[model samples]
Target: MMRILLLAVLLLTVACGTVTPPIDIAPDAWISYDHKTSYFVSDAGADSVRLTVKYASFTFLDKSAELLPVAKSVFQRISNELAEKRGTVRAVYDSSKFYESVAYNGVSGVSTALVSNELTFSAKADSSGTPTSAIEPVEIVQKLEALKKALDSGLITKEEYERKKKEILERY
Candidate 1:
């Protein structure tokens, strides 16, 4: 009977381990994001920004060896509005998003979230004095449009949209 019980426990562990993380667990870029990915931003003061990234509980990393280029895209967009912004991006893990999140991948049924870590990137201002932006940057207007789309699709609550809208506008 003891042997049977041990076998049962082993099976359970294997089943639980079957749950895969949404992002590639690469040594180089363990965390990644894409155009579909969205995150909340707030001013943490000291020229530091706080980003609430969503992540799957099944696959979470307290620290990744390197920051993915895709994640850096978020910083580039933010720097467009706050040209003077400086400091490293710090990631903090929290269950808040897991509690508050109603989002999931329809195809895989995996939750989306940021690994939540701080990374450092320096933004260099253009000397041309022209409005042209580096291709890495996304315009505020575009972000607003995306937020509206999420609302229209019922992906987020009206209150969430309003709060994010305010946060984005406040920085610029």
Candidate 2:
């Protein structure tokens, strides 16, 4: 009976270990909006811009272990907009997208290369300009909602949620 219990515990450990946590943008990430574009820069650094959406409803994926389609679309749109605005964009390091490239590609050869490449290039292009302090109130609300979702999903602790909430509120 002891051996059987040990085997069950080992199996549980292995099962839990295999489950990957969902990906979320940082609470302290910077958001900058200019005209029609809204840039959600990664808190990690200027190297990565988490999401850039233009005139669209941004939805949060529940319990998603991989980068969701909506998120990809936002990134892709940002890339296109950057190319249109600046004529060209240079590449930069992006850890989250890099992980997605490796993990997502391995799961299903449907490459997320475009999302990574576009964001990297755009980050470099946008880094040159000064971000405006003025951001749309709607955008701020959306970001807060995203953070709240992260908290609800157990991706962030209550303390983290409050801290991030305060930081975001201070922006406006």
Candidate 3:
């Protein structure tokens, strides 16, 4: 009886203490391979994050409405953190899992991706909104073109690429 009680307490403690770490990243570059994304974050930030929600056969699903919340959460965290540090979050890269409502065992959701312009504004732009130290409109066009290529190659879904492309253009 005593052993059972001790084990129960230990299990409860572990479950309660399982805090998911915040996604801390300010990447110079990255590749969002559908779900398993690899970042080029500096030494100060992790260079990768992975989700096991999908695997071999389940990989490369389309982004559904259910997954939008996960994506939004990721963007919000990074944007807020960067803002607090007096910097701009030019982009946020992440893949999220959305669980289904009817879980017989433990399950649920969809997929989406965002390829961001990792360029931040220079401290000195000299009146022009363009970042003096960053790429201009031409670069944005290049990024859009590259995104299209990714879509063509099936690296990213149509919705994911289109959404990312729109975000970049709107911000420019």
Candidate 4:
């Protein structure tokens, strides 16, 4: 009877064990998309600005109504902050997501193209806004050199090397 009880407890424990999903870390230049919203953060001068855009289905009228105000409020707050910093934030609001690009003088701004079927808007920046492309020239040169070496060593094809080289140059 004790053996049966022990076996039952072991089975219960095994069955109850929960497996958690791994957390995702956002990349250096891109922000992680949340279930209801996607946001990007950029630094301008000494200040950092976050641009958040919420998503909701248009078919769900109640849900859309609920989320629209929240998205507007968040956008307003970010716009106010940027204006205070003498910065500009541009965002495109589609039915599902908000794609944003923010630019400010004297600071690194996030600049990304936002395309939507409904609307497009932009605010100009005084300074060049290409933080992600601000990779060290030396590093890019090194990577190019490495690619060439790979081609020479027959580790990669000439076509692959050229494609990678073009991609590297486009970043600048």
Judging by TM-score against the true structure, name the best candidate.
Answer: 3
Per-model TM against the reference: 0.26, 0.26, 0.29, 0.25
- lDDT tens digits, residue span 103-142, model 3: 1111222233332223232233335444444544556877
Ranking by lDDT: 2, 4, 1, 3
Top lDDT prediction, candidate number: 2
CA lDDT of each candidate?
Answer: 0.44, 0.46, 0.41, 0.45
Q: Rank by TM-score, descending?
A: 3, 1, 2, 4
Candidate 4, TM-score vs. the true structure? 0.25
> What C-alpha RMSD separates each model from the true structure?
14.9, 17.9, 14.3, 16.5
Q: Output the better candidate (2/4) by TM-score.
A: 2
**Model 1 CA lDDT for position 161:** 98
Question: Per-residue lDDT for 88-118 in model 2, tens only?
Answer: 4432333344333211222222312112322
Which has the higher lDDT value, candidate number 1 or candidate number 3?
A: 1
Q: What is the per-residue lDDT of model 1 for residues 1-172, given as tens digits with 9 covering 90 to 100?
A: 9999999887655433322333333344332344444444555555344443443432233112123333344544543434444322222222222212223333343433343332223334455543232322234677889999999999999999999989777655
Of 1 and 2, the candidate ahead on lDDT is 2
lDDT of 3 at 37: 31
* Candidate 3 TM-score to native: 0.29
Residue pairs with colliding backbones in model 3 are 63-111, 99-108, 100-108
